[model samples]
Target: MTSSLQAALDPSAIAVIGASENPDKIGGRPLLYLSMFGFRGEVWPVNPKRDEVQGRRTVPRLSALSRAPDLAIIAVPGEAAVAALDECGEVGVKVAIMMASGFGETADPAAQAAERAMVARARARGVRMIGPNSQGLANFGTGAVPSFSSMFLEVPPQDGPVGIVSQSGAMSVVPYGLLRGRGIGVRHTHATGNDADVTVCELAAAVAADPALKLLLLYLESIPDPHHLAEAAAIARDRGLPIVALKSGRTAAGQAAAQSHTGALANEDRLVDAFLERHGIWRADDTTDLVAAAELYLKGWRPGGRRMVAISNSGATCVMAADAASAAGLDLTP
Candidate 1:
């Protein structure tokens, strides 16, 4: 399952369902990114209404394609998205990125049931789904960006050693933007909203297997599957790759907000902390804390212990460093 999920990250061919001619629209943005980023893959645009989308000849639907694409990006809304999935099952498309919303996050009983039904449909057809309300996934390294993030447009991508996997779309790219600002190159950024099918940790495990990665960052509202989270951490630990995670919803109000945002149930904060610690994953307090030490980790500096000696040209600066070290619980040796 992990291998199959990993394959979606670097698909040789992709079909864009609900393709649009307008570049700024959700359906068109992916086509623009794929062309702009230079994804050297077969791109089939599926839009029954259009003969062409973004200059590419369009197929009426997935069934019209000669063969199943490696991945499908479903950009339609509500029942339309489900209908697209039905087509995918018939055509044998193994993976899909669900960009449509109005699912479990809406907190409507019908919507939640719809989300569950979609997942059941996907599983029955052997299709692995990324999201039902996802922003999408982007692999800058391969130019295989199926996402419609304005962040990619606002912040130019430079492929590097870092990868980010989050349940929130904003959190996924927030670290990317921060790292890119510091001249850090990011290779993978993915979000699994609603987690109706694929959870964040499962995707992180796939990302962790990339030989080019040095660091992995995660942002989560919940952990419904700790087994995969542990698997992800094990993979990272085996590679000596640092995993920094920001698990939100420590308070009752925060938990409520998280549940509303992604249909996530909050885990006890202390247990989450212990679980991450046991797996050798660092638990960050905030977004800033998540990427603050990225550079240091990328430089291959792994401190074996907390004992440290402050060294600086200025005596005052050294004193400040010592103070900071002490505050962080690092022992300052005389």
Candidate 2:
């Protein structure tokens, strides 16, 4: 699955295709967060209509740039996204995070067709697309601030041992921030939107091989391709790298919502649960469990089997920990 295209790019120097002057706009947030966090890479702004954005000189187009950017973040309107991507491909941009919507979710059939065409065109050029409808991707390991969400504004760059591969962009930042706040380090983070080319399986496979990474936390709405996911999970298990997965869309209503969001069907929740158990992957039911499981694993605590030793300062706390652990399907003994 390794390609020269993935190896050649720095994953550092990123260009914002729809960089805007308004901080409230989508494109403006990444620029703002990147500058605020002091990302130590050349941040290029590609917007022909603007001379400057966020105090940086904006390049009229990607082709006019003196240096080819390793990655491009697309924040333009859905109608212009493909055109921006065409420019990115011409300039040899390796990875692109398409933050525009109006693709599969649109009520108009023509719009959906156009979105598919854009994806086909980009893939044909050997350029990887992350989302036509996505929050955006981020790589904290390389100081790549590609997401435009304001949540990252308060986050500082800290490369640790855990890698977060999330399908939901909103979950990525929130989880990353919470884990980082708790002193757990993150090596890399990705929010795979739409997953047009790079799926969560591929992302997990890549993370499993990262020498600096010891833990992987995933927030998945649904596993679109179970075979690929199973293969990736097996790889992670072989490496003794524990994966804590929070699989959303458990209920019928939630499943419907997940499908609507990404046009993906939520696999049978029981099947996913059984699959994770067979692979030695921990399943988290809520945000607290997700964080606790990851934190415990990252800190080198592992149960010999499902049995765990519990210690608490108070009886109520002890009872709670035991109940919580049992509810998570872990045996709390001794």
Candidate 3:
């Protein structure tokens, strides 16, 4: 396996720093889901306040651990998260998931400053941080599920070939569940909450290089660096891997709200559309469209020069499809 793929899939052991015994709590769900999903890796819970969480002995701190975990998931409050990350870095943990918020989104100036400090600390230590405000991430290929939402509550992990990257945590899970319901499998799903360090562009470039990944689906509220994203999209296009993007915050009002929420600036919707087109990336209008387009591409059919042939049992359905295609700027002459 390639080094990047190995690194992505080789998170053999994980530690939950704020794990709790209570099933309802945020820290308890990763442990619960990991066990229930039948993860093959070792699971450790670290909580100073608890003797044991979910029948597993809890380590008071990362310093007390014998072996270094490949990945660490921090579910503690925003204030304590930086310290936990520092401890993770000291232990030589490679990747970290920060599920706590109170960073860029918080209206308070002090909170934003604290968030910046956290990012700076992580960067200085050379540790890769996922989010100071995020839902979580999952590697279905390796059974590394580290998300907290009850969305994975009743579902079994369905391993597949598509890798998902989304800015919205809640939206990420929704697509996973939806795609699985439609018999599409996911290789990895990442919710990049308040992307302080790892941007969508970096993740997409990494996913493009992943041998296990056949397709990439992105749900983006805003792109921080258009140049970086364009370059990444170009790489994906060059590799002949299909990238389907669903862009939120398309309208002026929606853009304003997104900017306030993530401290991001949304570019003109038309400019984004042109950029994606130029990079050979497919644009999806809605959630269903996003999944459908991704599924079609992954199943190995590519459109020839934007021309499409319509087939329908009913005249009305055929006409509707033609109209939709025309509206989407697709050629339907054939």
Candidate 4:
């Protein structure tokens, strides 16, 4: 992972551009989460129209900051977001979490052009962006909840051994909510919406590098960068970390939805399965399957072989277990 992207995961300071006083707004939710979760870092709120946001003093612009923040959250809309990115880049912000929309996801020619232009501008200025329509990222370990996920408020966070990375914001936190509900702790939950600059695989590589993580769950609508996914799998494999991925868009209907949702091209499903298998990553059929074995994985259970024995209080249950095991390619022996 690049140093800039790494810094974003544990930034010591954050700037909220286009910050709002209302804690419910997109621009204000980050501040709400950051405070509610106890982020022990400097926060600079940038809003030309406001003197303070959520009771914290605000700066009129990024240029007014004493020094460039480690990460900047661009919460404005349309061209204003692009301008904020340019400002962040010029001020030497290491990474940016862009929360605006109207990018390539709309599938509009002008919007696509604008997205390309925005990316070029950031690349020229060396600022890595999270999304043009992202929900944001969260690290409970450091209380760096840059995301606006309502799940955080609903589920409450605890520092645990699990990490989640996904291309869809909902996918990212849904797994988190499930894991947390199952009494498993999740440390990282990041959603790279639209994958404008940072892809899910790239972020997976970063999350996989966390030594504290025991299990990594992923939700991918596309594999725009398979190389990074492979790299992430290798890292996890070497560290004995288990990765479960729910790669969507396997059917015609799902494929169309994936394209419209994120402007993503569907990778051939068969090839995706092969690639994941070769890299030692498990493929899950759905969200439930993605985190179903999280507890077992975290417990460090390593099955010696694909052999199974069914034990149940009822004979019918045992019969069903045996049938399921057989279908899953496990040898059912006495």
Best by TM-score: 4
Question: Candidate order by TM-score, highest to lowest?
Answer: 4, 1, 3, 2
Query: How many clashes show up in model 3?
Result: 0
**lDDT by candidate, in order shown:** 0.91, 0.76, 0.78, 0.90
Model 3 residue 140 CA deviation (Å) reads 1.1
Superior by lDDT: candidate 1 or candidate 2: 1
Report the lDDT tens digits of candidate 4 across residue range 123-155: 889999888789999998999999878888889
Q: Model 3 lDDT vs. the true structure?
A: 0.78
Which consecutive 10 residues in model 2 have the weakest lDDT in total? 1-10
Q: lDDT by residue for model 3 over 2-54, one digit each (tens)?
A: 23224434567889999999877879888987887667988899999989899
lDDT of 2 by residue, 245-288 (tens): 99999999988887677655678989989988887778988878
Write down the lDDT that model 4 would get: 0.90
Q: Which prediction has the highest lDDT against the true structure?
A: 1
TM-score against native, each model: 0.94, 0.85, 0.88, 0.95
Candidate 3 TM-score to native? 0.88
TM-score of 4: 0.95
C-alpha lDDT of residue 218 in model 4: 91
| Candidate 3: residue 111 Cα off by (Å) | 1.4
